[model samples]
Target chain A: MFLALDVGGANIKASVFKADDAFALRSAKLHYPLWIRGVDGLPKAIEQAVALLGCDLKGASGVALTMTAELSDVFRDKKEGVDKVLRKAEEALGSFKVVTNDGSLLDPDEAVDRYMDVAAANWWCVGWLASLFERDCLVVDVGSTTTTITPVVEGKVAAKGLNDVEKMALGEIVYVGALRTPISSVASIVPVNGLWCRTSSEYFANVGDVNLVLGLLREEEYDVATPDGRGKSVEECHERLSRVVCGDRNMLRPLQTRLVARFVYEKVVEKVCEGVLQVLSRLASEGRYPEVGFAAGLGDFIALDAVERAGLRGVLLRDLLGRDNSIALTSASLALYLAYKTGVDVGRWISSLR
Target chain B: MFLALDVGGANIKASVFKADDAFALRSAKLHYPLWIRGVDGLPKAIEQAVALLGCDLKGASGVALTMTAELSDVFRDKKEGVDKVLRKAEEALGSFKVVTNDGSLLDPDEAVDRYMDVAAANWWCVGWLASLFERDCLVVDVGSTTTTITPVVEGKVAAKGLNDVEKMALGEIVYVGALRTPISSVASIVPVNGLWCRTSSEYFANVGDVNLVLGLLREEEYDVATPDGRGKSVEECHERLSRVVCGDRNMLRPLQTRLVARFVYEKVVEKVCEGVLQVLSRLASEGRYPEVGFAAGLGDFIALDAVERAGLRGVLLRDLLGRDNSIALTSASLALYLAYKTGVDVGRWISSLR
Candidate 1:
């Protein structure tokens, strides 16, 4: 079995899988907000995730790793963050091969030396996974903390930007996400009783509360902590969402809070659609128009909404790789790719699963 | 001697003063960041601030408390937050008189029962102080975490909104601040080399970096923790500012970073101006337009800029009461007001300082 890990700033996902004749894959995810936990919390978090996945550390043939956690501010810079995360992984589960933006796996030392390439390369892994099914496509994976939109052409990753800055410039990355994005970051003013009121940029509420209030996300699925440190109940979400406009349950009517939620939902969708349109225009300029759009991750519905709005035929990656598997797509895809590279007939295994 | 405390979500400010034959006041501020440290850290943080001010807590007759910390997310709701913060204050200092939005002081038990009134009443104390100086004027106090625009009309506080929600609706509050405001909340797209680029919504940079890069704030004045867990040097500020667009020192040139900083600075100033204008229009509609504007607190320069844009005569509160005193204006003003109320003949002392 190969253990694949996708360490992000707000979440850490692990997938234990084998790519032989009899295929087996088990994945687990843990919300370990690196910004809150800091780099010091990585080892224990990684170990806890491995235990949750019920994977034997000694039995794993190799470890495949990709991380976006280095982007967290706990470290002074990305290089230090990447080095520290790698050291933690080694301390917990031994040596690992880190996937870089160039779609190559390098040893821990080499990855640390070229930290920028390895920092947020989880997108490349998911894109490679999408390329396996479709030669020309766009992959929109909206996870808990960020969204990655990647393009694949002629059976290879053809993204315009490799680094985060360039990717953001080209609309290959939209920083807004499903869960932890502050509501004020999405909307400066929200309408209440026909009056547009400015929002409190005080981290009073986040998108997760919006989704829960709008019935887009279930209470159990609200994995991250609520903005007010309140419960994730629908009623609690209303109170939290009300605070986006600096109100609470006693001050705002139920309908007003719902209005705020719907407004934020539309705004988030609009932001993702804007990114999709930007990417599509870039592709059109390059003379490559992808018709097939793949939506994956915890926020596949959000990605699908954007894909449909962008005038592309939306395909839910969850349909092919169960809902839970798709949420852990980056790590699972990395493991699958590594197995395929190691002479496993993963094509048959993947086809059987689908 | 009375010890005054202005406990905010991101900062804890204390002022030690006397309401006797001769008036004396000494103020000190500490950036406790209540959200990060949580309510458990409050007592210690308050004690440290008292120690910093070189005051004898036991010798003080009473503690005058006004807080915006109840709006922090560490507690489930404002009531719990207010109760906990009050408990911490009592534990750190002693019996206290909590300031309420009605511009009155109440004992601790009564304050807890009427938590909503006591939650964020610091603005009222500051407005009362402004009223003491000018019968008809708008007071713009831009602190590290939030801004309050209060109108003192006919020698009394005439703010249209009491709670934060209502205040936000009436433009009495602008949530952006000088130090801790996330850059993403200020500007979604920043101009880089004449091209508008979408910025990453990550907390990779904040307005403190923008102010530092623009020379509006010195290293020592940055005060709050940096977004990247880096130093307060100008070069470090440049690097953090660049990351607003997901770039770093290696990716962006010095000129590009400076341009980004300038753009963010302008956006912040514009946001504050919007709030000021909103409040001004409301005052004009009421047939009680304030001709003069008093700019105070840590972001006095920002407030002054906004006052100018709104066509109001700007007066820096710092010039009236030295720079350090003005930065801790909410607490200092509260102490001054309490002293005046106790028959200190503070009017003479204030004129002497001027």
Candidate 2:
């Protein structure tokens, strides 16, 4: 089984699978956050990731790391920066013959160009969409902190060579998310009785927080950003958001805060939906629409909201999660899978570049 | 003669006077960013705002709006929801008839509660350190996306907030800054050593990108989000990066593309000496810990940076900035003038908030 990990700025998810003809999945996905690493939490977080890996990863022949780490900071020379990544990954992976953007699987030759070709967005899973259709496709993978709209003609991510930091202000990489995004960033002042008063933009307010308040994010099914700033937990979220807008706790109340929060959530989602629609419209103008494919690690709300709102159709990410109930790999997972199936050594493909 | 407008998520600024004195300065400061009208480069963008005001604020006011606009996003809530800011400010300011958090004119409102009881983090500036210090006090307004470690303790304007959609990630009073920032959410990144790698959970990066990359941004700077499928600029970013990384420019580079694109700008600045050190650090930390004072605007980087690196000083911001730039002010020019005269708000009261 080839183990693929779709590591994004906000999420680190894994799926174990055997992908020769049919895919068999193993393991429940774990979604942790990149929020409070605070210079001291890195080791523990990595340890958690390792433990999670230990739970499902067994008898895996190879491992590929699809990450948003590349989106973290800029390098003087992007290519040279890629080399630094390989070294860090090498250190982190310990014995894993980790892949690189270079053609060589493991060696770090002085090939700056050869090593800077790995593609990752906030929703890194979208990388897998490259395998879905051979024709042109416009991939819109929206995740926490940002949404990336990549134009792929015949299977490739199209955009500037920007990491997550630089991409935050750009449009294709909208800096909003379903579960973890803060609310104040979405709207400076939401219309309240048309008076145009100021609002408190605290981390307490987010798309998910409002969505959850509005019944959009169900506690029973959705994966939420941890209230305590770790991997999400169902019980914890329910407890955290049980307050009503009227300041009542546990019991719900129909008031401004609740209504406002919910409406804002819907509007934020709508804004993104509109953004995707705009992107798709532009793609149509250029003939880059693939037989649409839908996939995301999120529950039905975001994807459904987006698809219904955007009115695009394709396979659901859950179904094509590639052969397993295994931590359904995101699109990036699918992209990596296809890369492997095509006799392309993704590690070599990445490392051998240039 | 240059009109510097700091349009923050919280306050709308128009400076007619150039740091001379209160009335003599001729700067008429009013509150703005009360509530965000729209994000489609409409109502809030420069031209729209001019029309919305129903007046030609041009030559009369040196028409400028300093904004934390770059701190905006589709998915994230502004650090301060554009709601409840003014009301809270009114309430906070109303309680304090006190003339200064600065030790100058002790208005009836200058009681400890008036100066110390902050309503929200946004009006950190209203505390008025400028009215408290006898000399030029440096202001280090460190909030979410960026940190304006300005040397406001003194008399010169020293920094600006312009890069990485700096205003958006800083605070929401502008409903545009950071609420609970994730390390990955700070700026974009690039892989190093030929692999896709995240920044160290430890001390890997800094705040220059969020506020210092593109110089100080004014209301006039507005770039359209790249057209989704037809966005040539995004494509160009892709091509440039792909060529560097050995990936095909015509196709999506998958996982690395967005991350790469996002990191491009921030990475470029990383190489510049200023990118790493906004100002000399040791020079700041070892000085006589001043009661930091910030200017009342989004572009107050110089003063804030000076205080942040100063280490020994108490931080402050203006009420104008949504958050960060913690020195709050009832009036920008007047507050500073009062602060310069008497240094009353300058207290020996130190805490371990840092």
Candidate 3:
């Protein structure tokens, strides 16, 4: 049997397979979060890894790990963060062969910093989708506080200045989002009935909270931050988010909440699409819309915008990275499949994800 | 015989008295910033309260406007950053007025709709100094990325915040210093020589370029942007700031050049001061210092560390705000003697600079 895992600072996900049927590995992935201490996380992860393994220590033959954990900027000290996780992994999973970039099962120090770009998988997955589907495309990864876009050509990311924060017309880093973004960072005043109305910077903070007020977040499927792994009660989220604008939940109608979410999303979407278009247009000015790949946890959002904004067809990764049994939603998740297929050792830097 | 003035989006200050007098009739008060954009500031200022006149505006005659230019943020829009010196002061400044507790001059339509405890200042001068100084003090406001500190006592700035960036270690509002705070925002990898190592989040950015980097600035010097009147020098200012980062200033610093500036002055100073001293143990901590007055312009920096960190002996202000006519330095002219003294309308808000 063989197992492949994807770890992030916030969650760990894994997929399993039988050696003889490696191609038939389960399509789903398991996720768990790592507790980042004053700096220690490795030891705790080993315990979690054991529990994740489920079977006896000798049951599994090979394990592969692909990670985006190291790319996470949540830690105050990225180096120490990586050290703490790697130390714990070494102490506990001492017997298993570790995996990382450079196609080596070596010490954490020896691993290539393949996952240095926390958001790299989002673009890579988009690349995979384009190569598999044979289409031109763009990818937008709308995470908590920032949104990123990537364009692909001939199975490679063609965009220069991959991190495009310029082009305010494209909506540079709105600093507003569904989670983690403080509302005060949003507009001090919002457009109301075609006129700009001043709003208190203090009164509204965190678009996530605002989205909750508008009833846009589904309790069952969108409970990304709620405890117990269960989503927030829709009403509870709404009540809290409404406070961003006013003390009354009635301050926002269902449509208003969605508009706020859409506004935030559009601000980011405009930026991402503008970035992709900038790259595509620059290239197309020379000839044609080169075949572009697409990937991201929020691939669907990217795909739709790719169609409307860039007038390009996006290839769905499930068509390429998917086997019949798999169900995944992220480019990072898709990277596991890409890495498995290409043997790129995507998890090569798992030890560094503290 | 001198006058002191402190102007802001929501407030305006004017003080009058002779050098030999004890501020006989301090009467400058708060008013709308847009008012000056449309009319002669001096004439309009007096007209607003011609009926409520305290000290004679026409009688005292020579007026100095130390403004926190209300509504200048819009002109700065982070684009079209500047224009031919506003033929008329541009429209309403930014989305909101930066403010202190219990102080505001704008009307309901122009104010924020919500309340926030984001820890802001209407102006980064007086309160910043009051946070540190103890004895009567005179403050020399040589702002920009560079600021100079001169102590005053027995009617002067008793203590100085110097680089308000450092003063943050004292007790004051955050020190995301004036003049765009440079973009590199890089901090030194200090403590390397000691048993421990401490890394600052400050990237290589300067305070002057933050608002103008993306051309998102305007040349309205009479606002929250700067404490002085040099607006057209942004290109030169940016060039100077870009050169000091000590590396490829052309390339984005490894850390966020923009966001990190916030940490350098605001977060870093706060954290360091809190970490270094639990009680007031610094030089000015002795003898319950009285008189917590301060100067405007770069007074914010001096106020940063002096007030809370060392414990003020007392606060002092100068009849003059900067070292303009002093033997200290040139091009380092401090905007001396704000008119917000005398516990009147302007004084009420001056006390609330933090």
Candidate 4:
């Protein structure tokens, strides 16, 4: 059995596989907001996540780790952030394998030295999982705060950017996400009473409220804090979204606020679509074409929409992996790869999930 | 002696004046972030502010209060928010006089009953202060999170908007402020390496970093938390500003990041200028032209820039009032007004500050 941990800036996820099998026996994701908790709290947070997974750390044959938490601003830079996160992870779970962007596993000491390769590389596990399914494909993993678009060619990860800065420039990472994206950042000007009004620069509302108001997300899916620290009812969502334009429900009608929400939602979709097309064009120039696009994580539907807009066939990764496994795709993928490396019947195990 | 309180959504300010004098003996402003503390913590926060002022709440002859805290999202609606904030203030400082937008003072129960009149009326104090100097003038108070443009005509306040919603629509309130404004909200697309790159919707950078990079604001002025929770050094500011276009320091050169910061600063200036024009035109239509523009608050320089762009004689309220008093304009204004109403030598006191 192998245990995998995907530590992110805003969340921590854990996956545990059954003994001598590729099947994920248990998986859990929790919102720990490492930014607020600071780097020093990371070890206790990891312990809490392990407890949530309800598995004994000693029971696993090996522990595999992949992390994007270094991108969080608690550290001065990504290099320091990676070193600190690795140190804390070591304190929580002794001796583990860390995954780099190029799909190589390294010991903790090596990871610190080659911090740039290990920093913000959580998307690689998804690429590895997609490469196992198809030789030439693109995978988009949309979490709460960011989306990563990874391309695979000839049964290998073919991403042009190994780190965040390069990935952002190459359109491999689009920062708009399913939740926590400030509504004002999506569109500087929004239509209000037949006039385009400038949005407030305050963090008054986020995409989760926009999605909730537009019915794209259920209330339960908006598990993060509402921008106003209020409840997640549709009425409350409208009130929060109205503040994007510096107005409240008392100032805007329900239909008007809904119209604003729809506009923001469309802008978010356009942003992701822009990133998708940019990545595709970059790949096309290199004579590397993807046959299918795989969508995973909380914003799988968003990835699928962008893929369809790009005129490519799209499939939900959750349909191939189990629902729980897909939501926590990075850890699950790492665990499954470890199982396969250890001579488990991974192909049959994935077929069982399907 | 009188103690004045100006409670806001993100800050709580207190000012203390000596008996029969408009001179502010002591005043202070503290960042409380009511959304995080909630309504339950308002009384404690107010108590803390009073302590900051170095004055005993019971030693004051009377307490005068003007608040914009009701607009905070801790309560269900403005009415409930007003009631709760007033109740908390009463709990903190005992009985006090509440000032409404129309410049009327009432007891706590009456203020709650007329919540709409009292909600977000902190601008009235600034207007009253400006009217004392010039019969017809426009006063722009730019605080940390928002700007309020108030007009005083013929020695009386002449504001078209009584509350936040109307103020936003009428251009009396521009939600962009000196600090805490997300950079993405100022401009959706920024010039990045000769190509217009769409900004990331994440709260990666804010206006504070832009001003810091441009030398438009002193480092001490940027007291708010940065979007990345990093240090306020120029290099760190450059790194944060670069991320506005989804790029980091490694991807963008120093000049490139500075270019983005300049672009964002110009956009912020344009936004405030647009609101200034909107308010000026509305006044012109009503034939209530102001002869001068008075600028105040932490963003006094920003207000002066907007005033100059509007082709008006700009004067910093800090130059007129003492520097510390103008920084806490609303609370100081309230205390001075109360002293004047209670038979103080307000005219000589104004000259004393000058």
How much lDDT does each candidate structure score? Answer: 0.82, 0.38, 0.37, 0.81
Cα deviation of A276, candidate 2, in Å: 1.9
Docking class for model 1 is incorrect
Error of 4 at A88 (Å): 1.1
Q: Over the stretch B159-192, how does candidate 4's per-residue lDDT look in tens digits?
A: 8899999989877899998888898788898655
Q: List model 3 lDDT by residue over A157-195, tens digit each.
A: 444442222322232222233454554464443322222
The interface root mean square deviation of candidate 1 comes to 12.0
Q: List candidate 2 stretches off by more than 4 Å.
A: A20-22, A26-35, A38-47, A50-58, A70-88, A95-116, A119-136, A154-170, A191-197, A220-252, A285-295, A322-354, B1-354
lDDT of 1 by residue, B81-155 (tens): 889999989988778788889878899999999998988888887887787777898899888868888888898
lDDT of 3 by residue, B65-184 (tens): 223343345334311211211112223111212222222322223322312210122233332333333334323332333233343344333233332233443322232334534333
Best by TM-score: 1
Instruction: State the displacement of the C-alpha of residue A178, model 3, in Å, after optimal TM-score superposition.
Output: 5.7
- DockQ for the candidate 4 complex? 0.01
Can you tell me the DockQ of model 3?
0.01
